[model samples]
Target chain A: MHNPSQSGASLEISDLSKAYGSFKALDAVSLTARQGEFLSLLGPSGSGKTTTLNMIAGFTSPTSGEIRVDGREISTLPPYRRDIGIVFQHYALFPHLTAAQNIAFPLQRRGMPRRDVAVRVAEALEMVKLDGYGDRYPRQLSGGQQQRVAFARAVVFKPKLLLMDEPLGALDKKLREDLQGEIRRIHRSLGITFVFVTHDQEEALALSDRIAVFNHGRIEQIGTSRELYETPATEFVARFIGEANIFSGTLVRGDAGLALDTPVGLLPVETRLPAGRQASLVVRPERLEIGKAPHAGSDPHVPATVRDVVYLGSNRRIEIVFDDGRTGIIRGSGRGTDVGAGERIDIRWSIADGYVVPFSSSQTGDGHGS
Target chain B: MLNDTRLRWLILFVPVAVLGVFFWYGVADSLWKSFASPEIGLQNYAAFLQSPAEMAVLRRTFLVSIGVTAVCLAFGYPYAYLMTVTTARLRTLLMVVVLIPFWTSMMVRTYAWVALLQNNGPLDRVFKSLGIGGLALIGTPGAIMIGITQILMPFMIMSLYANMVRIDRRLLDAADSLGASPAVAFVKVFVPMTVPGVVAGCTLVFVLSLGFYLAPVLLGSPQHAMLSQLIVQQVSQLLDFGRAGAMAGVLLALALSVVALGAVLARPAIERGYGENT
Candidate 1:
């Protein structure tokens, strides 16, 4: 049973920034997590997700920021006084300590009675499904088992907020998937707020109630997994969260409300960006309909040559090269006539299906569409 | 592959041949002389066991070696820990500082200590300036310990540093996140993990201290002669090879037993602490 006082704590981090000389690792980043919220900070490597996690755990002091837990400022506190639990990428389990002893370390430090410590350690072992592994040393365990011990050790104290920095990054895929489900179950049962940092978008999408996408030391966007996938705010979020076919052009008013004029043709666009401004139209592969010729409907269509087709069990991934020499993918259903390489085809999507992002100067020449 | 194996054996045979001729042969010759020289009997051993003065020299040698080992560990543990935690540039500087004594000969360092520890030397003048004059440290066991600890510290540091470099420092951070304060984390987590290093350093310093000769002969008084001094006096002054051989045999046995005991004490800690899989 969880203690009533240890249910969860709301975390509010404001204007957190860390600068080493002129290079800012985290720049004026701000975010919050309500009690019992499962929030994930997702980004590529060196994107400040880990820096934000370390600052919350008090392992690193920010250049300027305030970290508050349940309205109490803990920015100036030492890590031991912060009472936050952190799980590292490599499980930092004490090799000399047995599973039970490692789990009991925090409780003993808190001056719990010895009898109570034993009871709590036993409960923790069972909680991590390591009931009989209390006597074994860390080396005697497999990677998955050692990580389970690390997770048990972190949560055995029942800290209000838990911060994990790529906790599953060291495990194999099957083990990682299993642990992800275990982590979600534990989060729900403990009802504690969790701030997890990871680079894997699928892991973030599978785990978090709200995902914060980080890039270049700033929060690109923060929203639920579905919201991030369906309606990304920027080109970076659109490309980073999932696959997107991007077409860069100037926005122009067409028969449709707004269209992007590109080398191939005018593509339908949907965004708040005014006309005559540069923008990029993002279309998900599944939204684009591929055919030998233009469909009977009024959907905007563009001619493209098929470059390759990879058949999945349920669907096929068809890679197509546009007339402008840019590449795009289409998730063709299993029923389409076998489109081979070098075959010309027409691809179209409805106006509402295209999402437009303001074009910036940074998106050129990276060869991102492949 | 057969030629490679033959070449490996030839390379190994070189050291074994040299040791067999120069080292083990010498040991066997001395053991034989301890029993056979001047007459066939245990006369040299009985003569050694009979003399209270000689027995006192044996006891004092062991005591001084233990004291030197203890002092070396007290100073070297923190210094080696500092080497592991400091930046790479600072660590290289610290390493060079520790090795400066090693660059010079041991005799020269011992003579330097004689100057510092001798009566009214630089150390004495400093004490006098501080108004704590009349402290006679030069001829005492304290002076001998100081000389030997400084000379043998590099051995202790090297042994400790070799083992300490492999320690994963993030365990301390883990301890901190688990609610242990810095001091508690050091004692409960960090210190225990470094047990192998501690054992290695102590064993090296203790064994080296047992065979120490020049430092004690130069810095220590004749009235407080160590076992080496007694063996040398027996051979060079008393002209008794049998008695000297017996004393050398005793020293070798003492060093071997200490090393074997250290291995016994350290095996479990080394196995448990360095599993490293986690």
Candidate 2:
């Protein structure tokens, strides 16, 4: 009978930093999650996303800055006093406890009456569609069921903020997709603010209302999934979030507001940066049109050889190697003019589709330059 | 030849025959001699059971075993927990410390205890300096308990540590995040998970203590003799093989019962602890 929306708390973390000797795991990271918002901290391994979540959960303390929950500072508090619920990647269900007992643990810790604890445990089990599985131990359950029990145990306490650290990372692809839907449904019904940490970009985009992309102990960008995918703020975000063909070059001011003067040609970009500054123009695979000859349009086109052509049911993914030996991908309709490998083709995209972002050292290493 | 079934059985036979001759045959002989020695009857068991002196020895043996198990558990749990929590280098150092006792001769260690507990020895002198004078400890149950506990402590820590290291420490963090205090989580979650180790360690120490001959005899007196001491007395002094066999049979039965009880109590916990963690 607990009202989750009423109990939801706004979590604001500002200038949080954790230093282990000389290495800073979290360096001045700041973000906020409004009440009932589903925010995801998305990053690769060692990107400080999990560190931020641990700081919020009070498992890891910050060396400096504040963590405020509903306007109350809780940075110095122990994890038990924080009243926060966390679901670890390993599911962390008490192997000794049954599913019901695992859900009842938090309530029992709070000294809830036995009758109330049992009822709440039953409700939590039912919430996760595991009502009849209450008596089974974690080992007796499947991985997906165990994760469901973990989710139930985390939220059964009606904690204002719930943090999940790669909770679905262990499950198979099919189970992960199924649980993603279930998680969305649960988040909607419960209305508790959730901060999920994951390295899977598609999982972040499909599940989060907003995502904070992290890299090298810092947040590269934070925005809606559409905004992050369409207008990524930095070269790293563009490469990390999704497939992008980046044209690295110096920016030049032409008849178009700003364009990237690359090795291939001058690619028109619909983004603003200081003229003559080095930058990269990011273009999505789906936005690019590929054909044997240049289609009549004002969009800038690049000549390339089709290296590989993958046929999906509804779309064809063509891997093209540019004249400069850089590879790019273009997703077009499955039906085409029979584009084959080793065939010459022209790939073009409109200026509005090309996003310009400032270049960084990380972009030059491996993924972005490709 | 190695893959042949008969050859595999042949390879397995040598050790089995050695154990049968050297170990099981002696055990069976003692068991039969308990009843058949000095004519086949129940007189040895009855006489030993009816004698208040013998009964006192039996009761004291059990009490000492239980005391040793309790003392080992009390100290070893924290030590084992510390071993699990410390850094790998420190844990290795602690492991070496525990294993150092195992490397030395038990007799040597018990003799060392005798020197320490003797009148005006290092321990006695320390006690006297601390104002606890006239503390004659060498021939007391306290001295024996200390000796046996030191010898048996390595078993307890090793068992507890082996079980504790496999425990996913994140479960404690999960408990803390669920609003359980550190102490509550340790008692309810951590301690319960370590029950298998507790059972294994306690059962081993108790069973070993029941048949202990060296520490009790060296550190204790005839007045406070344990069951093993009385059995040795019947054999060496009285030359009463019947009484000695009866006492040995009783000790073996008690040890077996303790082992069976430990297995029964610990099976469910061990199974639950080692469930299929995908």
Question: Which candidate number would show the highest lDDT if scored against the true structure?
Answer: 2
State residue A170's C-alpha deviation in candidate 1, in Å.
1.0
Which residues of candidate 1, in runs, are more than 4 Å off? A2-6, A363-370, B35-47, B87-89, B128-134, B273-278
Model 2, docking class: medium
Error of 1 at B90 (Å): 3.6
Q: Write candidate 2's Cα lDDT for A1-370 as tens digits.
A: 4576686789998999989999988899999999999999998888899999988888888999899999999988999999888999999999889999999999999999999999999999999999899999998899999999999999998888999999999999999999999999989888889999998999999999999988878888999999999999998888877798988999888985677889998877766688899998889999987767876776878999999988886788889899999998888784453699999988887778888888876742433311
Candidate 1, what DockQ?
Answer: 0.73
Evaluate model 2: give its lDDT. Answer: 0.89
Q: Where does candidate 1 chain A have its weakest 10-residue lDDT segment?
A: A361-370
Q: What is the lDDT of residue A229 in candidate 2?
A: 91
Give the C-alpha miss distance for residue B152 in model 1, angstroms: 0.6
Per-residue lDDT of candidate 1, residues B1-278 (tens digit): 56988999989999999999999999998888999898888998999879999999999889999999998888888899899989999999999999988898998999999999888899998999999989858877788888899999998998788777887778889999989999999999888877777777888888888888998888999998899999889889999999998899888898989878878867766666572221
**Model 1: per-residue Cα lDDT over A152-220, one tens digit each:** 889888899999989999889999999999999999999999999988999999999999998878998
